[model samples]
Target: MAEEEVKLHGAWGSPFSKRVEFALKLKGIHYHYIEEEVLTKNKSPELLKYNPVHKKIPVLLHKGRPIAESQVILEYIDETWKGYPILPQEPYERATARFWARFIDEKCWPSVWSSFSEGKKEEAIENLKLLEKELEGKKFFGGEKIGFVDIVANFIAYWVPLIEEATGKQLLGEEFPALCRWKDEYVSSAVIKEHLPSRDKLVAHFRARFPSN
Candidate 1:
């Protein structure tokens, strides 16, 4: 493929946006990144046109077409660039990887985020425990090498510790030793370490967003 213009429309604090950004960086793809302010009602006209249904941020505009959903965008980047393959090449392995990725994106993410609210502690802990069990004794969700599922699972790990600190409730502890080690490895990776959001900023943002909780 010849040199093409790629653009990402995203918000700073959004994990969805960060996923795409990490993929792009890992693949050594040079693209323009437009950070959107999603807190307010206003959204960029480009974003509006790209994702008409969801009207959400983290839209990846490749050439002229736009792709929403972080996981979809990550696949697009890997397939298009062929630089750093995020998804496994084998058919069954690719399917397995995608399965876990979707699980993290759909189930684990919602449960983890729900912990921030009042009256959701029990449910959140149960959900987190399930994840811990699934991840027990695993270096990465995809084994040794960091793959698509690992990336998606660890998207919120950076915030989870701080959330625990803020709320004084530790969801990940000795009970999930492997998971804790995995979290450390995931965060320490160059791609994630460089691009992760500021901890102080995230704490302040969440504190303001959920003041009572």
Candidate 2:
């Protein structure tokens, strides 16, 4: 018998959705994953009813109440489940983790996305440098082991590299060897490595949607 009814409304390609999915899987939670084709206008009424404002995918319905936003859903999963805690137990460490997570949300992710969309080469390189400096000597964003911050930081991994390939430019430079190494470590995690979108599929998807120069 199932303990709680969990359903996720998310699109296949969305990194936000992938984050939520990874957190759920890490907690060993049984969930029904409904792939919402938001771009194709295939959202369900329940999704709209739950997240009225954004109406975005990656809505986690616990029992019946829906939670929007991938980060929030991750915290919810951590709090609701007792197994394999994704967040640290100590308050200070938890605060630090949250700070880095928010940092990625506010600073890193936006910069990367902007670079991807507008072909802002110089600005993208600058942002990537900042990230590299910030992550110097750090094993993961949250330190030794994979945590919430690592999950958020690595969210754009699949897309950013694809963007660079499409544009024929490497935003992650050899100068930032530490950050590049960190990226490899973060993505090579058993869970992340297994669940990430296929490169060929993503390249094809982006080529069709965002044709390069």
lDDT of 1 by residue, 1-213 (tens): 333579899988787888888888888888888888798868989889999999998899888899998888989888898867799999998998888787777777777777666546666666667667767878877777677877677655677887776666667778777678888988998888999888888888777767775
Best by lDDT: 1
Q: Kindly report which residue stretches of model 1 are placed more than 4 angstroms away from their true locations once superposed.
A: 1-4
Report the alpha-carbon TM-score of model 2 versus the true structure: 0.90
Clashing pairs in 1: none
Q: Scored by CA lDDT, what does every candidate get? A: 0.80, 0.79
- TM-score for each candidate, following the candidate numbering: 0.91, 0.90
Q: Root-mean-square deviation of each candidate, in angstroms?
A: 1.9, 2.0
lDDT of 2 by residue, 82-162 (tens): 887788889998998898788778877777667667766576567667667767878876678777877777654566777
